[model samples]
Target: MNKLGRKLSLSISLAVIVIFSISILLTQYFLPKYYLHKTKERLEQVSNEIKKMDKTTFIHSKETIENKYGITIVYEPINSNVDELNEVVFSQLYKKRITLNKFWITEETLQKLAEGKKVNKIYDQGKLKSSFFASFMQRDDMLVLVGNSIVHFSDTAKIVNEFNLYMLLFSIILIIALVWILSKKITTPLKELKDVSKDISELKFETVHIKTNDEIE
Candidate 1:
């Protein structure tokens, strides 16, 4: 309804907000995973390289790999120094603060890892998602677990959310301004016609004028 700017501004703003909100929601749901997938691919490559190293080299450089790539490394011994299921041998989270000390690794996963297998898992934390890619390799009496977490995506998701909020505010303001201008342009002739009718009814014979050439005029 172009009766006045208020209704028009409100309707247009709501419409634009619905569309933008859908877009932002979709982005929030999918974009982080897309980024995490890309990150997983890279992590897989690095894990593959680690799988090729001997047991000693892997244990010695576990910290270095964790530091260099900003991942968490955990070594689970199978044939050698067996740790309690809850005991973690080596870990470097790099400030990710992930509560996961034991990953999705199971006996089946360990068996596969012993044969130089790579595993990829996804962790969901409320609206946030993180990725884990690991390689399991057997070294004589030790099982080496090398992995990287795409927890950095949490920061990216936060940035995107903030950006979406700003964009929504901007869109509302812009749509309100445009709708106000358009509403004024559209209702001017009708408003003038109403005034002319009112004057004629009162027998105050004045020249009735409708400027637009449209049928309403």
Candidate 2:
């Protein structure tokens, strides 16, 4: 009875752990990817709006666009260095970098921009990260680099993973308790049957204690 109870408990625990662990793994993997894809689409839409704007409108509505989307737009002239941006634009860039300090603009990024392409990028700064859709199009003689910040799905993914871990732990503990109780109930009849068989082997009939509705019990 003791051995059978232990086996049942172990089996139940493994089954519960396997099922919930897979669910947790899937949630951890797919959900963030979905969020990231959605964010990319939104940022690309913002980039399109910027592309259609005239220089005067873009300059005037820059702050509004940034505020509306929770993003910073960095405009760089083809000839000027990144550090040589105008004071107002530099200030906006400085403010945005307060949280995320690092960004990259590779050859591919520049080449794509030269071809009037809007490229999507993922930027990381230590623990902080965000997505951006970048485009370098004709704005007077200058090539304007406009980027929009998208939602940081990685941060949300971390929070979700932590919550699921705690829930998984709690559920496992609960299932173990339930399995133990059920194993005890199931073993009761078997214990009674064993004792009754012992008495009959010695040529004595004894009242059995099993109360199950089955004929064998």
Candidate 3:
């Protein structure tokens, strides 16, 4: 490759690297947050749907709702004594037994529930990373809890980076070929001009017929 081809290839390779680096960083930082936000929104929607249903309808459809949404639904009485709240009533669909304390239901969260506000919690400690949505059912006088496992995007980021690596390799090869073609086209005209200058210096007056259509012509 000549000087022009080398320069063009380097510039394009640098631009491609910069672009892919920014894309990878953005995916690493923002993609998981966006997924979490969407998951929270979905949980809030489910909570609202439960709030709209009557007690009998909600109780009868508990299993169906749990299966449909892939979430665990639990309810606890709105007791003033938090310590007395040892166990929360779990839906029949829930296989594992869980205590009220496991849900991270604190005094502040209870207060928020009493004031007609939904509380959201993220459990990131155990092997199962999950998000919980808690809301108060005024009609039934019950605190409704909905829990769903959170999907981590680390694996997704890894897959994307791997795909980008393959694409970068392919792009490098394509850019090299493209740079070679372009440099040949540009230098062909310059080479012809150089030959014409040499001939003129030797007093060989031949008609220079360079038809490059650009200023190089």
Candidate 4:
């Protein structure tokens, strides 16, 4: 096979590969982005319902929680010790928790909770899994906080998440570059082949001496 033929074949194969790689990359990029946007929209709709009541409300609600909020639960209680107290505590806490949009609390926020004050809250981007509630009320000589881990955020957790996102984006760019270069190399030969074929057909040569297809499979 002549040098020209080999080059043409290489270009054809490269074109094929580049096209395939581009298709794959586009699929990878768009599907996740589309679904993520959809999820964000859906979550945002529900996210606004979270409510954090004042400590006094948290306390007073406990007395009437069962009558006000009790319903059949999917999970049964393992132990039935002190049923009324448990129901009251669970209902008061769960009602507040169910309305929370994001899982996070600051020391200032906790302080307010302890003092029976109200504060606006935002979700902690660092922690993906916060959906807990807490109540702090002064009793005699002590300040008590009752909260579940579901609504807290940590600084280190946010940093780690940001790092992972950067790594994912870097990996995506690397893959795209690899695909692009491979596409260019593979297409170069195919372009040559197209030119050569055109010349042959246009001329209608009785005997062509070109050995160009040597590299073409």
- What local distance difference test score does each model get? 0.65, 0.66, 0.73, 0.43
lDDT of 3: 0.73
Q: Write out the backbone clash pairs for model 1.
A: none
Q: Which candidate, 2 or 4, would have the higher lDDT against the true structure?
A: 2
Give the lDDT ranking, best first.
Answer: 3, 2, 1, 4
Clashes of each: 0, 0, 0, 11
- For model 2, which pairs clash? none
lDDT of 3 by residue, 1-217 (tens): 9999999999999999889888888888998888777777777777888878889898888778878877677666778776555343433214444322244457887777678777777755344433333333334578777766665677778899889889888998999999999999999889988998899999987877777788987
Model 1 spans with C-alpha error above 4 angstroms: 1-19, 52-60, 80-105, 121-135, 139-141, 148-166, 175-217
Judge candidate 2 at residue 89 and give its lDDT. 46
- In TM-score terms, candidate 2 sits at 0.54
Residue 165 C-alpha lDDT in model 4: 54
Better TM-score candidate (2, 4): 2
Greater TM-score among 1 and 3 belongs to 3
TM-score of each: 0.51, 0.54, 0.68, 0.27
Question: Once superposed on the true structure, which residue ranges of model 4 sit more than 4 Å away at CA?
Answer: 1-147, 154-157, 201-217
Q: Indicate which candidate wins on lDDT.
A: 3
Candidate 1 lDDT by residue in tens digits, 82-193: 3343244333233346555445446665567567655555544334455455555555656555555555455666687788889889988887788778777778877787
- Per-residue lDDT of 23-124 in model 4, one digit per residue for the tens? 555444554456445434433322221124354554555435423332111111222343543454455445654433343334554455457553332233
